[model samples]
Target: MKKKLVMMLLAACVMVAGCGKTAVSDNFQNSDAKEQEEFQIEVESKIEQEKCFLCGDAEDSLMGYYSKKESIGIVHLNSLYVSETRVRDFDDDGNELFQQGGSSTMVNSFGEGYGSVAIHGNPDRGYTNIDVSVSDKDEVDFELLEDRLCQICLDTLADFYEDQINSGDNENNGCSGYCLIDFQTKELHRLSEPYSGYTMGDYYVKYDIWKEGGGSDWHRISVFIAYLPERVASGN
Candidate 1:
């Protein structure tokens, strides 16, 4: 797959143990050994002009890579290791229910914001098929998230096409991708492969919003994005 090949190349270039990297750099071609560690471009912050993708913890190895103030809507995993999981359905009072009908520890979530992000298996395939999620938060706007995902899909598709044209590869055989979750509709929406957004799913861009998790706060709005590896590795 294009994403896999790109990631392999990236790993070779950076000498990282795994295939995880952040998207702070404006373009991929400019990433160098030193720039990858120190951060590339300086993205402007939304809450305050001073806030930035690089404004967060500096010591956190992966989280600090391309992450700034917070993980996108989904919490960022500190490492690139895929979490262990089990997705099996059983009967409840003689009625069979989807294993995902309820939450499980297998979500493979990382950090916390309004909610954390998780990925489970598909209703059909066991571990092979996966879906991502954002744990329940006091406040969430499904409509807004849906809209933003649509826009991101379009942007990603555009990038894919541009890359294809530039590379003169008309064939798209290896770029199988994942779909985004629509909290409003409670359904899966196909996300264009290699979303234009950050690869780690740990940065909260403009489309992502989070409420403080302090004393008393209600109106939960946490989103769990299913599917990884695919989301992280774009075919570009």
Candidate 2:
């Protein structure tokens, strides 16, 4: 009789221990689910706040690049429909110096102003130089010029990348490229390959403003945006 009583006690203890473990596990799972729910709510709130200034109608709108400035409205990015002008270099003796290249100009209309990007390239030196300039009809300020120039460069680069992806000629072979933009300093940098030292995911815009003259009414801005990918850059 004593042996049976001891056996019953042992069984009861085992059952209690098993139940304790299950209860602990359930508590842990509930805690995890609550944390996840909180995180999801936070993310949704952020997206909702961002929707205020975001452009939802345009297909080419750069929704990823957000600006909180009051002056900036819903920004759009579009492909360049540049007009090509043939350019040929000649020595003093009228001899061609390099292979025939062309200069292309793409002008975009901005708020109360206009911005243009001129690309000069040769077969030997593909896209040797890119000049970004902006001006306003009435009066242009540093803020307007800087913003317009950066936007133009971003649109151009994004258009180029889209072309490469659509052509199935991307040499990166599914590798991704990122652009870093800094509106404060007016710098734009591109990371063509993975792990290029600089943190990925931001496009920087860097440029110098050279006022034609102290009394000049218009602003002539120069933009420098890094283009590192050889395939898309060289038109290969």
RMSD of each: 20.9, 20.9
lDDT of 1 at 226: 30
Residues 119-138 of candidate 1 have per-residue lDDT tens digits of 44342332222233323331
TM-score (C-alpha) between model 1 and the true structure: 0.19
Per residue, candidate 2 scores C-alpha lDDT tens digits across 124-144 of 332223344434332212232
lDDT of 1: 0.28
Clashes of each: 21, 17
* Model 2 poorest ten-residue lDDT run: 36-45
Superposed by TM-score, candidate 1 places the C-alpha of residue 104 at a distance from the truth, in angstroms, of 14
Q: TM-score of the candidate numbered 2?
A: 0.27
